[model samples]
Target: MTTVRGTIRSTNTIPADGHGDDQSTARARAVDGLELTGYDVVQTNTLSSTAAGNITVRAVARSTEIQPHEASGPNYGAARAAYLQTIPDGWISLGITVNA
Candidate 1:
């Protein structure tokens, strides 16, 4: 419950649209973006959807750390919004997961 160093792989992936050259690169960006959005990303992976063209990104990440600073102020919301801004066109949010 409250003592969770236990973050799940809720990493949201940006679409491949001009974000990176390949899946590996995109995954790297996912890690960076997650961190920028206020997550201490521990592990990362990618999943491709069964859906058709241009919708091929699913970033999986687990946040192993949650700082005390995250308990107040704007938290990840404002930072997350800024991070989302960096995502190029055609890449909608796959979404984010709070510590579970």
Candidate 2:
């Protein structure tokens, strides 16, 4: 069994060029497995002022444990591959700093 944990920090420039608060959103994914899709949302913070606004989000995600019996598939990598595809497309990962 393996455990995965991470955090996310994001910010955006608002009211750019007098452009009235551009709508924006951010997303973060856990690991590269189907079971890793679900995460516990730790905290989300928003800082706003006359100059700029910022947002910070934190969360923790875990991967599914593989059973010994289930590891004998014809395609050894199929389990992992299936889990990878289960992840949503364009999902942004914010745990780079931790892993890097």
Candidate 3:
């Protein structure tokens, strides 16, 4: 089994329409080492916005370690579920405060 842990931070400009550039923020952080050992980041809190100042996301990631041979169809499914189950479905941004 392999265990992975990391921190993720997302930031974006707040938009009036409630749409912000969360994609770039997530992408940037993804490479920072938030991705799990045997899993990948399917999505980030992008659809949500920091329309007020800046969209910020901070999460402490923890994932179970699965072996390659052990990763059968059912195991893969369980992994997927375990990963997706942690993230929130939707988020509502109120405001943001930019720094620097």
Per-residue accuracy of model 2 over 7-80 as CA lDDT, tens digit each: 32222111111111321332232111113333333332233323453322223333222211111123425543
In candidate 1, position 65 carries an lDDT of: 28
RMSD of each: 13.7, 14.3, 17.3
RMSD of candidate 3 to the truth, in angstroms, is 17.3
Model 2 lDDT vs. the true structure? 0.28
The C-alpha stretches of model 1 lying farther than 4 A from their native spots are 1-19, 36-38, 49-100
Cα deviation of 87, candidate 2, in Å: 4.7
Query: For candidate 1, which ten residues in a row score worst on lDDT?
Result: 1-10
Task: Please provide, for model 3 over 1-100, each residue's C-alpha lDDT reduced to its tens digit, 9 standing for 90 to 100.
Answer: 3222222223222211122256455446543545455434344443344556344443333333332211112344554444334433332122222211
Candidate achieving the largest lDDT: 1
Pairs clashing in candidate 1?
Answer: 9-61
Q: Which candidate ranks first by TM-score, i.e. highest?
A: 1
Decreasing lDDT order of the candidates: 1, 3, 2
Candidates 2 and 3, the one with greater TM-score: 3
For model 2, where is the 10-residue window of minimal lDDT?
A: 11-20
